[model samples]
Target chain A: MTRVGDVLARCRAEGRAALIGYLPVGYPDVPGSIEAMTAMVEAGVDIVEVGVPYSDPLMDGPVIQYAVETALAGGTRVDDVFTATAAVRDAGAPALVMTYWNLVMRRGVETFASDLAAGGGSGLITPDLIPDEAGDWIASSESHGLDRVFLVAPSSTSERLTRATSACRGFVYAASTMGVTGTRTSVGSAAEGLVARTRAVTDVPVCVGLGVSNGEQAADVARFADGVIVGSALVRCLTEAPTRADGIRALTDLTRELAEGVRARRSTPGGAPGGASGMVASA
Target chain B: MTTPGRFGDFGGRYVPEALIPALEQLDEVRRKAMIDPEFVGELERLHRTYTGRPSILTEVPRFAEHAGGARVILKREDLNHTGSHKINNVLGQALLTKRMGKKRIIAETGAGQHGVAAATAAALLGLDCVVYMGKVDTERQALNVARMRLLGAEVVAVENGSQTLKDAVNEALRDWVANVDDTHYVLGTVTGPHPFPEMVRDFHRVIGIEARAQVLDLVGRLPDVVLACVGGGSNAMGIFHRFLDDTGVRLVGLEAGGAGVTTGRHAARFSAGERGVLHGAFTYVMQDVDGQTVESHSVSAGLDYPSVGPEHSYLLDIGRAEYRPITDVDAMEAFRLLCRTEGIIPAIESAHALAGAIDVGRELGPEAVLLVNLSGRGDKDVHTAAQWFGLLDDAALQSAGAIASADATGVSSLTDGVQV
Candidate 1:
């Protein structure tokens, strides 16, 4: 199992869903992003997903697009993604790099895998690289002892869902909505059904993302998922902040609130949250 | 996931999972429609009655004078109903949209040719149409934007990521993902993920089919070479697919060289691009060393994309076809030559092909017969052409005004010292 898998297992052992927070490296600047990620870990995020700001983020909404544009304008390089990953790992949370496939392909898949492993990164969460086109990444990550996290959506066929879940090493990402990443007033109604469908296919932990923002939404997703993944909400803290320090504080406070929401689900009896059942299935 | 759409290792669906089912449905419907006689007959009827197909092949001896005395034949795609080859694909995809029971169609366009075609098709079929155009492009091709709006389509100006065709495509994909259930993404070119490159190519294959038969009937033999501009490569691929089996015919694609390839301000993908994924297909993409897509520049908004279609990449790799860069200066010079010599105004995108023909004509010398795809008319490019030739400047306008007054008043002094 990968370090990310172990972290998810540990969170399940604690009878709570894992809180995964994402922030693009070099949002304000590289050093500032690393500090923010470190603060997230200290504030109760179980895993840190360091986003590599791409030039064309097709699956991103305006807030994340704005953050990525700022990050790219600030000169975020591929090397900085690893640096931020190391910072997150140093802060005691498992770190995963969520990136588009081209950057890794540009760096050479094996070379990128080795670099991420060297930086103590647990795995990758590829938003665009589905299992069908991930042969090279799957092999490279396995050789480097890193996880491969592919996503499943409501539109995914059962065959594709099984293939994607079976390919996943650490966990499977379930996008809660059909649209790109952004905070919605409420998560899509299809998310629970998609998560349940994914769980039926593989023993890999299923994490839900794509719209969860606040504690209520996080707790709502945590009720059915093994992990609650938040991205735009956390990145918006940095994007809308007056100062880097304030951004870090906002990130920390939000992380704690989301973390609390993930834990709060365990108090309800007969909740049948995926964390406890996923641990059993994997075991 | 399937390999049916691949051209060697180039084309595949590298898109979000939410789009996969839609692509699969589109592929299935397209495959069936291609084999269905009723569908094929309906499309043929549309082409003959609506698009004015068998778009005549014209011989231009005057223009050929500049091309080293070579015999030049023009495939008159400019005469198509929507004024370009884009109508073929949009009409076919609109039929497929109706087949899928989809109510609305969304499209992305750069030069606005495809958007206008898509809007036209949607209006003809009684479907809602929305076109995503880059903010920069909406201004550069403002005439086409107005045309689209007049065709009863809503035009959205995409504002992010260089604000060009690439960004417009990104915005269109985002819209498709959110609204895939009831809306069909009428992708503008021979790019994008699975089925699009293949389906769009199939729809446009008539260009090559008709040209090949016409050249045989007129010239009594195949031309020595065929040339077309490579933007997303639809027109080039359209006219080249039929001649692929003819080993003697040389197929060359002219890419936009805005300033020059070395200036880092051109859209010559095969000239200076690396193999990477962009807009869902693996192809020659102009990207930084870190794999970040670099902005492509071109005087012609149609060819201002940073990536080429995957099949073009495959063709280049196998040496079945050749691609070369044509600088803006060369293209404009050819654009003017076509206008002055042949009295034909070609789209700036097609002017790139005219520029390449000039060079190739010289290389092959007088006996060579060159078939050039006049992909679109330059009515939409009059503004850009006027600016390029300084015809829109105050001095030139004033000179023309003076000449007009001289004609009206029979006054020699009004015409004196006037450039006109």
Candidate 2:
């Protein structure tokens, strides 16, 4: 299985932003979620984030929370999440585990990291954990040779941006808006500025999420970001579908459109490696 | 004070990225305010003048007879402005909102005491306030909803995810995330992320401070047992903080055992809960094997939370305090005991502590002195209590001197002069 770093680097080499897709594990059920993720990978999603279902998802809006509640009701345990990650990895996407920090802490951080690595997961995205509180996780991820991804928001100060990007290994997740995860009619204007500000601190690839639902918004974010992440939109497609097959088809169709939109913005101005490196040098 | 963001392995900032800067700002401002005399002076003045501070300590000889003839002292926080200890934390946070220049305060309520207190503080401070309450709780405690509205606050009924306090908290958090710049989330209890448990505890510490001094004046010694109900543990921590260093004073927290622990329906965290994360605190939460939070059942809506405060978790861990569960039957029996013996109608939440005090007093013998925190008045629980005692029937209501429309002519005359 490919690492998330290699996927992003490959996307950069091709002069386009990576299309990262997110879905909770065991959403419809264990096998159903895996098949849906496989469909997303085949339809051109470069990186996949398999969320571990939690009861209280403070960061999630309605759509993903509903899906996760259903997944939990269907008995999606941590072991099932590992199984789902392995299946997604085998399906040809670098599967990253995105989850609340408690799920990892409850299972012992080292054990969780090792098990995810054994399941062929590339990295982790901790939505609620900040860089300052990630000491044990940093050590565990390093020991397990797994990526550590941290999030930055528009409200983050320069010091926080530097700390977050420095802590991140795979990519930095930039929340496109100052709210919970859901689709929005328009992405926050601060997202582009935030990406530029984050670039000034580190050369790590920056991905923007939280409001990218359709192809146009994906293309708009793709112009400035190293990766474009779509989560609630994909979950909405699956949740609003009448059947499992319809859900997979909807997810695949959306993934294909988003991939095309991200690829449409070929060779963004000053998007080359040197442009990112120049910002790092200036910093 | 021990550390900013942790209570042993229990508490930290486990919120979304969007609220990071806001939380940092709140922590910074709160730290500065703690040392500033003007802020301290303002809170003190509000307590003395507006909140009727230094709430009296009353000893009930008759009530003591029920507790195996042990001397019982009650710290009367129920006499506060909003009829609960919730007012203390609300006033402190409301002042903090002014210091931070936030114009709006949003809060979540379970039994509506916190909502009323928040609304009262907001009105006193002249800030816009909005409260989210569970739909079921709104029906149960409709008077509190009306009280919040009368105090010039907006009450939003939350209908999702069990339609209870947890769901109300989620909705309030969503509002704060969406509007963090102009809004301050007035979390009701000693829970949530960093600074909240610590900050709320600091605000309510006066309960212990005054009670300690008052008890020393009255009894010339500390209490043998200090007890309070532990729903999110604000009141327990408030009265327990000063007594913690007094090694002889046994601090006991009474959790609401709705039925029994054997029935899988109770809010007894130490007795039945496991260590897991919920509502931003890594505390003793009732959860399944898969880490999914199990809903807690308590006759007292205020005590129906699954997760407890992190500070309580730390105290329970370090052997500084002990927590026990009180069943609904025993609590209500204690509730009636206080009303009949001491002429004090204690909230059902507070009756749990009273019930624990009875058991502890019996165990410690007749010479022991027990200090129990009367956290709130039972005026808000009249309907629940009426139903519990089968006092809702016409005969029972009339026997209780509830009017039963005997003065219909006079009532009609008064309504005739008023607009419909």
* lDDT measured at residue A73 in model 2 versus the true structure, 0 to 100: 80
Give the per-residue lDDT of model 1 (tens digit) for A102-218. Answer: 899889999999999999888898888878888888889889999988989999889989888889998999999899999999998899999888878888899999999999998
DockQ by candidate, in order: 0.61, 0.41
Error of 2 at A236 (Å): 1.0
| lDDT (tens digit, per residue) of candidate 2 on A67-132 | 998998888898888888888888888899998887887787898999999999988999978776
Which pairs clash in model 1? none
How would you encode candidate 1's per-residue C-alpha lDDT over B215-293 as one tens digit per residue? 9999999999999999999999999999999999999999999999989999999999999999999899999999999
Sliding window of 10 residues with minimal summed lDDT for model 1 chain B: B406-415
What lDDT would each prediction earn against the true structure? Answer: 0.90, 0.87
TM-score of 1: 0.95
lDDT of 2 by residue, B1-420 (tens): 122678787787777667878888999999999999999999999999999998999898898888988999999999998999999999999999999999999999999999999999999999999999887777677667767777788888876676788888988988898889899999999999888999999999999999999999999988899999999999999999988899988999999898998898998989999887777777888887766778888889899888899999999999999999999999999999999998999999999999998999889889899999999999888868987888678666444323222221122222221211
Tell me how far the alpha carbon of residue A271 in candidate 1 is from the true structure, in angstroms, after superposition: 6.9
Best by TM-score: 1
